[model samples]
Target: MLKIYKTKLDEEKKLLEDELGTLGQVDKKGDWEATPDDKMVTQEVQDEGDMADRSEDYEERSIKLNFLELRLADINRALEKMNGGNYGICEVCKKKIEMDRLEVNPAARTCKEHMDKVV
Candidate 1:
């Protein structure tokens, strides 16, 4: 059972990393940051529409990158817990997390009772 969850987590981690790589790069602090489009240096006057489009695209990528970063953080935490022999335990209640919940979210940090309190 643990092996199954670990495999799922590994697959999810790889997928998230790949998707994140398409939109950004990891920084010196190991945090993902969205890369903006290269600024055009041509002498021709730039259109306002083009500038707005670039800005919108950059904002979208930033939002997506942030979401992926949060998920990656959770997955990493779960992996660390597995290594420490503390995986699948509710952080708030100190009990074994229900298998069903774990199946739904392998990185869950709390049980259903404390699900709302999860970080």
Candidate 2:
């Protein structure tokens, strides 16, 4: 069961990274930043306006990238816990997390009872 969850989490992480890379680039500190490609630039005033429009698009992408990055971090943390023999244990209650809950979100840090306390 843990192996299945890990596999799914790993797949999701890769997809998120791929999606993020398409709309942005990873910075030196491992943060994703949305940026327009050079091809968006052209030799015309209207092209300059297009650049501005692209900037707005990049901003939206940045917001989405940030969300996905946070999820990826959570997934990675769960994977790390599995390696340390702590998989499926709720952080708040230290109880075995429900399999159903784990199925829904393998990265969850708390059981259903402490769901509100999850960081």
Candidate 3:
């Protein structure tokens, strides 16, 4: 069962990395930053509308990247727990997480009882 969850988590990590790569690049500190679309425009005359569009696009990418980064962090933490032989245990209550909850989100850090803890 743990092997299955690990596989799923690995696949999810790969997908998140791919999606993040499309919108941004990892920095020296290993944090992902959304690439500005304006950087792609070289010597291209841009009107105010064009500049606004570029800004909007960059903002959208930043939002998306942030979400993906959070999910990736969860997945990474789950993987670390697996490596430490502590997978499927709630971080707050130190109890075995419900199997159904694990099935729904293998990256869960807390049981249903402490679901509001927000890791």
TM-score between model 3 and native: 0.94
lDDT of each: 0.91, 0.85, 0.92
Q: Which candidate comes out best when scored by TM-score?
A: 3
By descending TM-score, how would the candidates be arranged?
3, 1, 2
Task: Put down candidate 1 lDDT per residue, 28-70, tens digits, no spaces.
Answer: 9999999877672343228778777787988999999999999
Give per-residue CA lDDT, model 3, range 1-119, as digits (tens).
Answer: 79999999999999999999999999999999999774547654347777777888889999999999999999999999999999999989999999999999999999999999974
Query: What's model 1's TM-score?
Result: 0.93
Instruction: Indicate the worst ten consecutive residues by lDDT in candidate 1.
Output: 36-45
Highest lDDT: which candidate? 3
Off by over 4 Å in 3: 38-40
List residue ranges in candidate 2 displaced over 4 A. Answer: 39-49
lDDT of 2 by residue, 3-109 (tens): 89999989988998899888788889988888765556655336677777777777788888889888988999998998999988999889988989999998988
Each model's TM-score, in the order given? Answer: 0.93, 0.86, 0.94
The order by descending lDDT is 3, 1, 2
User: How much is the lDDT of residue 19 in candidate 2?
Assistant: 90
